[model samples]
Target: MHTTEHHWITTPITADILRGALDLEHTEHGVLPHRLPARARAQCVDGQLAMAESQPSGVRLVFRTRATAVELDTLPTKRVYVGVPPRPEGVYDLLVDGRPAGRAGVTGGNTLTIDLTTGTAEHQAGPVGTLRFTDLPDSVKNVEIWLPHNETTELVALRTDAPIEPAPDGDRKVWLHHGSSISHGSDAASPTATWPALAATLGGVALINLGLGGSALLDPFTARAMRDTPADLISLKVGINLVNADLMRLRAFTPAVHGFLDTIREGHPAAPLLVVSPILCPIHEDTPGPGAFDLGALSTGKLRFRATGDPAERAAGKLTLNVIQEELARIVEQRADEDPNLHYLDGRELYGQADSAELPLPDQLHPDAATHRRIGERFAELAFTADGPFTDRSA
Candidate 1:
């Protein structure tokens, strides 16, 4: 039951160095570049700049997508989540679907609340933050938000009840995705240029980017999050972080993945869910991880030191990429019967090779901007089209 709503048309606004408070957020918003680069000096270092000269709260909306694309449905009920950057006290109004959703601000901590049931205003309170609404009308093709007061607020994540609509006719199938920093586009050159963003363009499906930089360690919170959300297609890019971050050992990895899949199945028992492992990394491929740096990488002064992963870490069943892949094969094979819709995408196929031409990870990890695009393209080819995203989903 949705009524005619005012569709907010988005205007191209270049990110700016404002005259207000600056709040670093999980997602990039109100900035020149859409993503925060890994090295801090990359091209898309939008959020790296200092806050506005003025003390006013500089705001940015941290929605999951740079722009939210919703298809015209009989009844569009979408719930978008924008991560709240740690903020101070202030009452900010929120206008969604061209109505007064209400003002939500932080009195102390970092969260704000807006009640759309109250008033009707064309403009909402500034201090960009996360908010949710329901019963979006089919005619409301686009949703434009206004943060009049703050220079910018981080729009972290976004979601919808209906699938993302394709452009022109706006009737494409919904595409849902989940992954780690690579998927989150942590150090990409630009927001729209992230691997997921690029893949979305190639596939023409609505995107649900669940890439939480350092937080994609296959936790219950994440699995629960996925289960709660709806998607026509789903993909989970796991591994690496577990090894890189040294989050767990081989003994724990298999069971943890089983638990993760089990959790998602609670909600999406029938939808296709793809499980992807990490790509090739010289430091952690067949070799084991929880790697240590080379002692020689350290400067005598000790002010700056670089370390390489210990070669010995890959002895047998340590934390290497090969070991994880084997475990994944086992997990997927065992679960395939219970969950016929389940699938597995080997990360190596995305970037592995007999030649093994390694891309130098500036920090001994994570891909550079160019590599990110390459990964995205490879992913799009394998995941999207064919029978589905990751057409080559097998052992």
Candidate 2:
């Protein structure tokens, strides 16, 4: 806490200062970052969509300030699944001069409890919480506060001992990426450790992450949002959500993929557009889904997912992880004839059977922290290096 003699300067949270978010909504308390814009959000009225969009997965506060201490006030909506172990508290990562400085978390926020069996959700109101970072070197430096990736956060106010300005843009390419919850940081230990975030850091790119949990269903509105957003590079990780949600058949999925890419092409016709298939999820690798929580694991205070659909259903056009990978590869090949910039990277290339053998997904779905680091490192080497699909055209 700063002494009274230290006059706090409050800075308004504006678009120019926010990074890795596509849209910002004015809330009663303050501004809420949305991975999908208002127009896109309006197109979907489901609870999953609501929760996913509101949670600012890769959103962060970026600025340059001379403050020795900083305080951010926020209202967060935390999710609670009924009959399961309580969720971990969200972490706020602070980076000074582009180096990891410290990590913190807030307490006492609104809780949304969802009953999986009944498909009912109840909201319990809570008070706004403050995250304070102090005892820093008193000099002008770039500062970044990566918001909690899993919680829906309303940025109420930011106060610093010194005046703050937007961080100057670097010579990095702007990489816009979209995917499901796994890409949304699922089990990644911290905000900055998410695969996409880690990849961006290694690739030296500015990330606009549009990864939405349980909601990457090839929605046209999401496609439209990506179509309109500006980016130097783009990538889409598809399939897992489609399978887990049991949202579509392969017959419908192929056309949806084409349509989504079609929309993105409307804006960036020649940008490197890499399409990634799902990572290895043994449960969904051969079996179809509607993924269900593992009751046995749940009873033991663990959260694990199991494919509920029969493996035989794949013959009926029901999509499985393996099926999606094949379809996606074919789809990308067909499109690549006309769109030379289009490329495909099988998710297995990032995390396959062998990698799984060594670093198993704790939940039999999303990767753990170490796997995230591995994927990010591999992605950088595969996609961002020379002769990679995402190699710079100008070079």
Candidate 3:
């Protein structure tokens, strides 16, 4: 009996073949893509920001190949809650010629266990794992391997049955968006299924998603990173993280919003800049936060969040989603007179009271997979369609 021997070609992971990441760090085991630059990362000591920026929400490997089979070796850092059931393995989505073709999950990788009660984390090292995709067409096609939106993945190597080259630029407008955990794909089905990724597809634009879970606190470093990054269109989904983290009071929040927008305009003066308020979050709509996890839910093998602060605190300058939306609207309106390119979108327009009634947030904070699709569709219609803020006037 004769057996076929396949020749596999290995390619080193590099920035040229990557999209959505701002920087690539060469680690001892592999290359890690970062949403924030080294300088910005150095300015902050928050572990949440460090972890979130490294998760690669919208990052992907894009190349042109006719390979019948492909394998990517990676070291993924999976998260584990101390008391709750272990979460499922992260998914890696594959796209062929700009359409979903396959999905895969790796078995072995490192783990970061967290004790929510103490806000502590412990890291455990593990072996590298490989994701494999086979049975491709013989004709040349553009292939994209979207990294897990919620996992910190260090890409080790790419192996294929046939040689691959970096995909040629499609010349689509680049949309740079920054938001909270919801946008980071907390409950998203897969990396490519995140709202930003879906919206980007429908809008026919390239996406640079800076959706950092638990860390979108309007940090100046984040703003600076966005200022430096090249993009044709820009947006910020603020308020949710700020209110939940109890990061700032009303006084500081106003200036922070202005400063964040100022920094972005410094780099993209004429680019359409859209400021989006938080979607309708009943828990934080009238109440303030420091949001907390519901301990009782842990016993039921379900993790849930609850707003912990008092609504009366609003008298003392504490913020709620309602207050935030009003301030954001006023800020945008005040600036629009001087900056015609600037625009504002009340996020309730994407997911509001009516939509929430149909698809409630399972965790009471982040949206479920179905809600992500709804929000993405609404955003595409509102921002990418005719007479929208992101409408291509040049066309």
Candidate 4:
């Protein structure tokens, strides 16, 4: 009989741990970058740079992995996704140990297909299957994977020849996240280029992005989802969406925040959790939000600045970014006495007045690719690199 040692496995994704791991760097060079024979509505006038699949290229992906054995009968599995969501049209090709396994993924269906050539196991996305080639020759060394781009979003994780190391024994770890569209990479650049994707690249962790563009209002379902998932590293980037979506009022906010945290604790008893407030938004910088501006054409009248009164209403409705930041400090300080892993990271510190002054975001709603890069660098420095978050690789 075969034996399974269940060697420890490390998450290959180094990008965002929020919604999906946005693999921008790969998408730019892969299938989607090919700019398909089609055109996608651009997110910005300049175009979706960091996350958009503008120019597509045929690039091979390399997955450096070590395999493990199974006790018996239970086949192993590995799953690769287009990581970058809000994906446009694109094509992905898969290869194993240099063998052309085949390709799949459609703009309409959001699915994937694989041809083993050997026809071992068939996988698709819409039908959303996994392509598996088993009973190997046993001489495999490196796994080479590839995904071409489309005209929409970028690639997430390219298909792989090597599967994720067979799950280890004991407990499995997960990465949990919650945030706004920014965390969802709303209008940044490419699929893989979002800030979350960039940060994940450096973090080398599992991900579960809960970045609802207009929806992150600390909903119960969201809290339940977090509470249900088994996580190793958990983070919640609140405020931005609550402010942008104009979703809640402070009267209902404080309890919502506490309840959100409480819900997650149900699943992750002592997991490392981080709470981040919004980054600086000059439109709402000190002005408080539900920020808004009259984009209507100047009525050929005076050049006076128009006020929508929405920003004020939004601000009054919920906590200001600074307010959340301060409250987060208090929450963590109070919780720190009981939970050593609970941490608070100010979004401003990630992208605040200083960063805005240094390199501003494009639409005031989203950070530019350069800014994303900067944020990635800082996140690595503050959270991941050296002896930081990776400390609990045991997860």
Candidate 5:
């Protein structure tokens, strides 16, 4: 009887092999990729920002290999609500030469259970899980593994049947985008299915997504991070988070937006910068927020959100979607005379009343998977093609 030996080579997870993350931290178990740098993280002690930035929405491992089989060990922190149904397992997507080739999900890891009613969380420990991909073509190809967009993952180990090297950088323009939960892949089917990821593929640009769920509040630290990051194209999806969090009134919002843009300009003086407003969300268009969970929907075992502030509050300087869109347009127009590269796009063009009728937001907040695809397609058509703001001029 003849037996064949299967040789496995282990590789360390390093910054050179990773894309999209601004920094990498060595943990006791493995390496954790962070969208924001340590300095920015230390500036604010908010729990929401910490969790959202660590989820790795657009982060991925890119390498050149001929390996037919590959394995990755990860420790994922999964979120679970106390009363609502558990979310589906986080997915890891494999791309071969920029095409989706395979998909898998990790089984066991840590669980973070949160009680919305009490605003408390309990963490339960679990074991590390391995994601295995096999039957890939033996020819040399560029391979990319996109981590879960919604789950915080720590890369523990990487093993392959053949030696691999970091993929060489190409001439693709890097696109840096920032937004709210919708941009964070709240209900997207998978990591690459997120709107920004899809649009990046279509636009032929590298992506660095800084979409922090419930946390895009025009913070100075976040703007500083974006200012320092190198990029050819940049976009800021503002309005939703600011409205929902009720962090500020119009008195503070306009100047805050100006300061944010000023900081980004300090670093990227000539990069094409596009400012996007919030999509048409009927629940919050006229009414102001301070959004809250719908108590009635809790009985259905699903989570839903509703605006709590009164429509009359708008008279008192309370911010709403309508108020934000008007202000953003004015701000962008006012600044465009001096900054030729700066532009604006109304979010209604991406998703408006007509779109909501066709594809309603499942959670009354986040768009479903299909909506994500639609929004991505629309964005690619408007911004990446023709005379749109993000169109590649050098080409």
Candidate 6:
């Protein structure tokens, strides 16, 4: 709170230091983060795509500063679902020297109201918000200000009591990941607490998370984006979005998965590409989708999802979790003969039958904060270890 000897300096948010965001556009107020590139975004006009890419899940501001006090001015679009419990304020997690230092939330920002019944949303303007942290160690340290995962944040200003510079890349491999809302930090506590974020921390890698909510269908544009993004490791968590969206049948699904991987291979032929299946979601395990809101739970002020399609639809080539898993495993196994770097990870290994009994999905879809932590830990152990798919091969 004390500004008396604070030699405040505004740092330029260049692409070199910003993590998790695919693109950044300067605005009248500041810079806006976009999880998808402009070209890719231009190819889609859906509302879900707009919201998901702008939500900034896994995005963070990284730099090295000797300043002990820091203040960041931002304009966050906080979403509120009417008739249900209000979501918590977006959290800003601060890390110094790769360790947790503090956590805070912005007080004022834009608000987005959603009507579940009609699937419509309204935006309301609000004043800019600020996040401040003080009492940091006086010595030079690597500082990471992780933005809100659930809120769309516009970076207005970043001020520190001393000069700052881009943090040195400590030889960390970049991990490019693509998945659905669950991977986008849906119900997680904060941006850094997302499973991918946590896994990045444990694996000692930088992350470029392309986890778009409701938009993870096997689009060519998304595959192209992944192909062009520089990465030492790549992963795709496929299935849930496809099933919940009812986007394709078994016939289209097979070729689509192959095309998606083929596109990525065009860019990096030898990069470790791990294909992950969906985690357990009882609603869509045997049943098909398009997933619908559980009206019964909504009436009591809760948000829950249910699969609306009949289980018998599988005979007609309709996709379900079980079907997708089998196909993904087969696809990966068949590809691994020629593409030795390719691997398959059954998502159930992260959160499956036994674990679900104790830590069930609160919304009947996405995992909670505790599950996010569990998944992150499991992923780190399984994928980054010496025998895992992402093990370093440079001997």
Q: Number of clashing residue pairs in every model? A: 34, 0, 0, 48, 0, 0
lDDT-wise, the better of 1 and 5 is 5
**What TM-scores do the predictions have?**
0.56, 0.97, 0.98, 0.57, 0.98, 0.98
What Cα-based lDDT does every candidate model obtain? 0.51, 0.91, 0.93, 0.50, 0.94, 0.93
Deviation from native of the Cα of residue 15 in model 1, angstroms? 21
Candidates by lDDT, descending order: 5, 3, 6, 2, 1, 4
Model 2: weakest 10-residue lDDT segment is 1-10
| lDDT value, residue 295 of candidate 4 | 35
| Runs of candidate 5 exceeding 4 Å displacement | 1-5
Best by lDDT: 5
User: Model 2, which residues run further than 4 Å from truth?
Assistant: 1-5
Cα deviation of 316 in candidate 5 (Å)?
Answer: 1.5
**What is the per-residue lDDT of model 4 for residues 1-395, given as tens digits with 9 covering 90 to 100?**
98433433334333221122222334322222221112211222322232222322222334434432111110111222221223333444444444445454433323333221222333443312233233334443444333322223333333333354322222323556677666655544443445655575556554445554545567675676677655678888888666644556677777888888888888888888888777777665444555443333223221112222344454455556656677767877887888777778777777877888888665557676688677766765667765664355554
**Candidate 3 lDDT over residue span 194-276, tens digit each:** 99999999999999999999988989999999999999999999999999999899999999999999999988998999999
* Candidate 3: residue 82 Cα off by (Å): 1.9
The candidate, 1 or 4, that scores higher on TM-score is: 4
Tens digits of per-residue lDDT for model 5, 130-157:
9999889989999999999999999999
Candidate 1 lDDT over residue span 1-395, tens digit each:
96645344333332222111122223333332212222322322222122211111212232222233322111111111122122223334333432444444331122224222232213233333444444445443434232322222333333454433222314555555656666766446544456776686677655556564544577665677577765667889887777766767777777889898888888888777888888776667755545453333322211111223554765544576777888887889898987888888888777676414656565555676787788888878877767764443452
Clashing pairs for predicted structure model 6, backbone only: none
Clashing pairs in 5: none
Clashes of 1: 34
State model 6's lDDT. 0.93
| Candidate 4 CA-lDDT value | 0.50
lDDT: the better of candidates 1 and 4:
1
